[model samples]
Target chain A: MNQLLFFAGLKEAAGTENVNMDLAGLTVEEVKKKVFEVYPSEQLQTSMVAVNEEFAGQEHKIEEGDTIAFLPPVSGG
Target chain B: MNGKQVWVTEEPLSPGEIISRVTRRDAGAINTFIGTVREFTKGKKTLYLHYEAYPAMAEKKLQQIADEIEKQWPGTTTVMAHRTGRLDITDIAVVIAVSTPHRDASYAASRYAIERIKEIVPIWKKEHWEDGEEWIGNQKETKPGVPTKEESR
Candidate 1:
């Protein structure tokens, strides 16, 4: 299972903070594709992805038990 | 290296607390920068500020900043703490403290910490003005030759 977390504006936009998916052998991009497929209208294009607390590009591989987090652009001063 | 120290909290951050964390007998100079929620911005009446973070990424980037400082300036200690959730006027939004053997190193490291944190850390702020609240992304006044949002990405 993969654990997905959303924060800030992305969380508000998704209307949920987290989800657990049972995709065992998918890459990070594939998981992102599935998330957008489920929430078709949500904006995933501009969000950033992280795996195991590290910033990751879409091509990174995802394994079972990895924690994935999506982050929107930061605006803080 | 003492390692990177980070605190993400909703309560007000104390300058003394942050100072204590980074202080060491080997370091003579310490520099700190405190970011507060101001009551005015461009003639608008600001009520409060709301801060949010991609907790995992924020912490990671903060550690990267700390590491970079240690690489650039040897024997310096750094600490960065940011408050999440709501903050009232005069409340510290973020605090950065650096200790070094010399004053210049402390200043440079502290400034670098804040600048890099702003540029890379996934922390966002919303200004709750009298009219409405608006998110302020990574937009800021830039120095010439420095990278813009598009350039950085």
Candidate 2:
């Protein structure tokens, strides 16, 4: 199972902190698209992604057991 | 040898402590920036703010900021501390300290550090207002007049 995590505003938008999915073989972009399909947010289209805690490109592949996060534009100062 | 000077603490951030971390006998000037939770933003009354982060990744990015500072200003040491959890109006949210042998480098490096943090750090903030609450994720948040998911219902 792959673990998906959410943070901050995304957490409320995701409605849960963690999710388990069988996302193996899917690219990061595909995984993100799936998330948006499930959560259905317009603002989410602009979200960035991270795989295994590192910022990942859209084309990066998601392997078995990889944790993914949809980071909605960061606002830290 | 260089040391890790970046930190994410739940306790209130102090510019003094951050400055002390980067201070050395060879340093001539120290520059500091403090981020505070203000009572108003764009005419809205902010009751408080809640900050959150993916701790491990947040720290890693902060370390990257420190490294970038050293690269840009040789002989400079930078330290930054960010606080999490709920904060009231006027609370200090973040403190950045940079020390160098000269004032110009110290000032420039300190300025660069804060902007870089805003651009790259994985931390986020949710602002509580009198009428409603808004999670400010990115710098380009839409106008305050828009309703949140809860409000839109």
Candidate 3:
């Protein structure tokens, strides 16, 4: 099972810090689309994805038990 | 030494501590940028700011920024520390410290560190206002009418 993590606004919108999914051979882009299906939000549309502590692109492949983090637009100093 | 270069802490950020990270016998100049929470944004009276980060990734990107600064300005070392959790107005939010043998390198390196953090760090902020509150997007972009889960209509 892969865990989908949400932060800040996305966490609130999804109503949970994380959700579990059976993601096998799914590209980051595919997983993103599925996330939208599960927890649709306008903010999630623009949220960037990260896999294993690195910013992941739509084309990046996901692995088993990997942590997929959905980050809303960053606003750090 | 690498992990020591960047941090995400819940303690009140100290610009001096960040500067201490780079102090060395050879360093003759140090440059620092301290970012503080303000009392107002646009016209809204900001009550406070709530900050969060993908901790592992935020620290990773902070190191990346430090590395980039080292490459661009030889002989310089960078230190970046960001505060997480709720921060009241006038609180110190972040500090980027750079040190080198001279002023020029430290100045440019410090500038590069802050800009790169804003562009790449996986951090988020929620602005609490007197009337309402909103989560600020990448680079603090705020949009009206977008509802949080609690207030979704």
Q: Which candidate is the best by DockQ?
A: 3
- Candidate achieving the largest lDDT: 3
> For candidate 2, lDDT tens digit of each residue in B1-153?
224588777887767766778889999999989999989788989999999988887888898888888988999988888889899999998899988999999889988888777767789999998788887865745332222332211
User: Which 10 residues in a row give candidate 3 chain B its minimum summed lDDT?
Assistant: B144-153
User: How do all models score by TM-score?
Assistant: 0.84, 0.89, 0.91
**Cα deviation of B117 in candidate 2 (Å)?**
0.9
- By TM-score, the candidates rank as 3, 2, 1
Residue B61 accuracy (lDDT) in model 1:
74
Decreasing lDDT order of the candidates: 3, 2, 1
Off by over 4 Å in 2: B1-4, B140-153
All candidates: DockQ: 0.33, 0.47, 0.48
Candidate 3 per-residue C-alpha lDDT over A1-77 given as tens digits, one digit per residue, 9 for 90 to 100:
89889998999999999888988689988988888898998777788777887777777889998988888878988
Per-model lDDT? 0.77, 0.80, 0.82
Candidate 3 residue-wise lDDT at A45 = 78
Question: Of 1 and 3, which scores higher on lDDT?
Answer: 3
Let me know the TM-score candidate 1 reaches against the reference structure.
0.84
Model 3, B89-121: lDDT tens per residue?
Answer: 899999988889999888788887787777678
Q: Please say which candidate is ahead in TM-score: 1 or 3.
A: 3
Stretches of model 3 off by over 4 angstroms after superposition:
B1-3, B140-153
